[model samples]
Target chain A: MTDIATRATRVVAATGGRRRLNGGGPRAGTIAAFLIPFFLPFVLFYLVPIGYALWQSFLVVRRTGGQYGTSYTTFGGFEQYVQVFQNNEFWSSIGRIGLFGIVQVPVMLFVALIMALLLDTPLLKIKSFFRITAFMPYAVPGVIAAIMWSFLYSPQLSPLIDLLNGIGLHPDFLGPGAVLWSAANVSTWLWTGYNMLIMFSALQAIPQELYEAAKLDGASNWAIAWKIKVPIIAPSIILTTVFSIIGTLQLYAEPAVLRQISSNISSTFTPNMLAYAVASGNNYQQAAAISVVIALITFVLSFGFMRLTSKRAGL
Target chain B: MSNQTLIRESRVSRTVVMALMFVLAIYFLLPIYFLIVAATKPQGDLASTNGLAFSHFQLFKNLGTLFSQSNGIFLQWALNSVIYAVLGAVVGTLLSALCGYALAKFTFRGREFLFSVILGGVLVPTTALALPLFLLFSATGIVNTYLAVFLPSIVSPFGVYLARIFAAAAVPEEILESARLDGAGEFRTFFSVAIKLMAPSLVTIFLFQFVAIWNNFFLPMVMLQKESLFPITLGLYEWNGQTSRVPLLQESVITGSLVSIVPVIIVFILLQRFWRTGLAAGSLK
Candidate 1:
């Protein structure tokens, strides 16, 4: 018994590092047992919802006879899609989120990259202190993050506003023109550290020896960071960019929370927010169409970006 | 540049980098620090005092008010969040590990296709699924219940994706083969051997799922209507929206926000190592 256990332990230790250990374990019945628990919920919650949304999107609510008649949904055949296409509020919400993503995602990712690089360098002291403090906001839910920042952005109670006023540089953080970026600022604060940690972990995985030859060649630290480290971590960057794009498309909680305090953020401030508004107004069919459209746009933009970058970078 | 000048320039640049990092740190932490300060104040002193300074010690009173208001509904929301997040993550992680281990170890037909479909599930924005899920749950008569939020929360494709990678890296097939030779069944071997091996990686998946479920607002927002079933986030949102009428609830909202976030932040800091490993595994690979 002892000898058999020793041999088994040796075998386990020896093959532990291998990636694939396929073709030897379980039969189909057993495999289905393992997968059914997850796949059932995945189908029920995930796949069914998408299919139901598509089905719902195609059916339009119509009255049985005249104005006072009972209402029921029937096949509308792209009528809802046409209405969605013609909606100025929908188009403007899309445009607004597009602009927000165009600006906020890059800005947030850039700061995250810089912070990650800085943390990865030998020049920084007390690294975890700075790292954890910066990352602390991520633990706060987005709604709470918005609530926290809302206090700072409000003119009636903000010390930061007071400080700015003291400097004779009066700024309106919650003004109509600035509230979108104000919401953007809340998102950047909440996510930059999380993204930074992603990039930083990637940076940490680069073997120290990869920088040895460059240093011997007298490459400055900046050159090594931009050339060797950044290039090596390009895949992680692309992955983060794709995740950020998906996140940007789903921007709801932050803007919705901000709308509680600011009159500037309308009901149709974002595509997801617009969907929620329409659904709340008992227009589930139109809302489903908007959701499908948003998901499709998300698919196109993220995949298109991946394809574009992979083609250009030969990644 | 000469070595002497290089040393001097290095000092300057290091100071510059450190300064920049310090500034960024302040920017990230400012709102949270402000929230802490705000939560400690009396309702009367909130607008009267400097927002970043402590006016007085009203935190306990505010928390009392938060938990005592409307028959202690805030406490119910907190308990609901804990139930939803903790239970959801535990089940999600277990299911993910089982499926991921099977995918890694078994060479079955249509396996890759199934995984591809699940991978695509990762990109689907969950907020888009909410309204339809709400409608479907309504159909099934599960709407506005704990199971409504808990059921959907257990289906994390990202958790499965991460688990597959970890299982591929961590669990050894030889051990499973030997366990099978000992006449142990597959489930028995998994529970006895594979789970022990993948314990560390499972913690990472658990933490990831926990945070995702805890941070989830939109799903529960759409699925549940009863205030008693609400998570801390939706509860606080409701409170914040009503702050204009009940001015005293502002302090409680701030206090509740601070209270709701403290435990998660503590857990996050405690399990900091798992997250870096998880992200490194997920992205860099």
Candidate 2:
């Protein structure tokens, strides 16, 4: 790592020297012209909206006169946040996704890690075929994947149900008890391959010399993988985990699509969906609060994971 | 004797691994296989006949109905999706490339600060912005318009991040210096020389943005109100929601879902190498 850093610095210094000899870098006008196009929309779409949401979250709606009076917004500090915290539906959604992240993230990452390790090993044949097949679902949109799986989950349509019944084992994929896991299944199917590719790429980056030493010491392939490869690829795993945590908290497309078919999924099935439902129902302030809360959770979890992993890696 | 035993052990382990992988492959392909088979079956056979088998070949009939349904709204949705995804991707890629190139090659004040701001944008979940964007757009009277979705979709922070990394890695300083020495303007040098070097990574960025826009649901769901403005995702989702009241629409929904995914799947398979490199770079970074 230090060698790479030194080489990078050397290259930068060489470029800096050349740049100075060439009458300095581009003028400020050129830089501004290039960057303004992206920053315009970025500020408009991303930064401005965040500020708007934060501002909106602090406002509350009030009926001025009677019950049927005109409704207007007033600055009510923390009122919307208090309502969100007190809302049963919001809590349920958070709890549901919390359960989802705890269970699904680990299971998906474990499966991905195993696949990555297997692909890294010499035992696998037709590696490209396996890799592509696994990664194919990542290309499928979340809505469509949920739609496709809903068919397989539907008792009226699925032949898997028929076969299972024939064997006297009836499975209810969209039952209230199982629908969350069913949604979890869709996410796992969609993301496992992508995560596997991340891990597999990291595994490929491991030095061959490190493994040669293990081999010379008579360490089995399994031992070498468990001891060396997994430890070396820990940072990659943490990265994927952070991404998965963020994805889990922002779970809307899958459950929303699945909600069409299954009554088990409520309007507030996920926090994002709940926020949307509220916003569509004309409760923009409260929706903004929910959005802020979800965003805060995502920020904390992602940054916390990064901090933990970097500390462990002694970076 | 030890060598023979080792060979035997290796054979057993290889077989186990192969079998495990084969099962996993089947698991991965099963839903897609089911969709294909279901798309080919008549409405009557969808529930009665086996899902894995074909009772009657009705793929063309389903396609016909899917296209002609609701005055060809499905096709309209498909067109809208293509326009939104393709145009957004093209514009987004160019903007990202420009900004990323400037960030990488230029020695401007507050460059790292600007890049850090963009990196912070990467962590801001877009879903959190949907409501506020809706409120803001509605206030500006742009809600329920194509611009609402298109404007937001084109501003991909992740795309900019990827482009910056790619620009830094692929475009060499010496080339830019030579281009400058040849009296080429900064924009001229970028357009003439730097873009060609960054073409592969640009394709990766384009593909990423394309998939993102195509898969986008929440933003469109909030931004657009007209059925005519819906993307395939929102369109199919609406159809899926109405399946209970209109059972016949189920088959069309299935067929439409299958139709919508084929192009994306084909793109993935054909551009497999770009995605592989993109994923590798993403993880490593």
By lDDT, the best candidate is 2
Candidate 2 residues B31-128, lDDT tens each? 99999999998888888889989889989999999999999999999999999999999999999999998888876556779999998898888889
TM-score, candidate 2, is 0.96
DockQ of each: 0.55, 0.63
Residue pairs with backbone overlap in model 1: none
- For each of the candidates, the C-alpha root-mean-square deviation to the true structure, in angstroms, is 5.5, 3.2
**Per-residue lDDT of A1-315 in model 2, one digit per residue for the tens?**
998985675556455653241237776677889999999999999999999999999999899789989988899999999899999999999999999999999999999999999999999899989998999998888999999999999998888888899999999998989999999999999999999998998898888999998899899999999999998888889889988998999999999988888889999999998998898798988989999999999999999989988997886
- Candidate 1 C-alpha error for residue B168, in Å: 0.7
> Ignoring the other chain, what TM-score does chain B have in each prediction?
0.98, 0.98
